[model samples]
Target: MLSEQKCEACSIDAVALNKGERDTLLLELSDWHIIEREGIPQLEKVYKFKNYKQAWAFSNKVSELAEDEFHHPSILLEWGKVTVTWWSHSIKGLHKNDFICASSCDGFVENE
Candidate 1:
């Protein structure tokens, strides 16, 4: 499964995913969107919750997921929702890791 994939270490040789590659991989994540802000690409998804505590707990779980993968995401916490965007800052674009992280976040919501 996508979430089981591990992120690779950064290297001068690492390259960002091409458009076709990104699009193809995105097929696996139906709820995610590819958004470019200020010319940088990212995979973003918003998750709704029953209440503030549920959302907060979900955010914390995602934090643990990110730490385990060593690929963090930008998390926006709200009263009943959370927005997560995953991107490889070092590459200035999306990577397979971003998609994988996004998948794990989806799993968190699923198992909640």
Candidate 2:
């Protein structure tokens, strides 16, 4: 179970893991559509938009957020959707940073 101190909400949980524990956490989060391909935990949520323009706009918004936070995710953009994944490379494992990014990502979706 995730520790309450690390929980960013019911949806985002912060994990302190070393290199060895990373794979395990990544695997676990992957079960929820998150993956550990970028040397960290990742998730690609398909955001639906009414048109290509809106999709691009949303992608840009996410880009701005990523830049401001100094934590970026691998983004996959399609006609009407954008997929964002979060991970940390320096620690070689999950960190509070990931949860912070997740919370920010969640806010984007929640507010939209």
Q: Which of the numbered candidates is closest to the native, going by highest lDDT?
A: 1
| Segments of candidate 2 deviating more than 4 angstroms | 1-32, 38-40
Quantify all predictions' global Cα lDDT against the true fold.
Answer: 0.89, 0.59
- Tens-digit per-residue lDDT, 3-104, candidate 1: 677777767778999999999999999689999988999999999998999999999999998898788899999999999999999899999989888888
What is the number of residue pairs that collide in model 2?
A: 0
Clashes of each: 0, 0
Residue pairs clashing, model 2:
none
After TM-score superposition, what is the CA distance of residue 92 in candidate 1 from its true location, in Å?
Answer: 0.2
Residue 98 Cα positional deviation in candidate 1, in Å, after optimal superposition: 0.4
My TM-score estimates for the predictions, one after another, are 0.94, 0.62
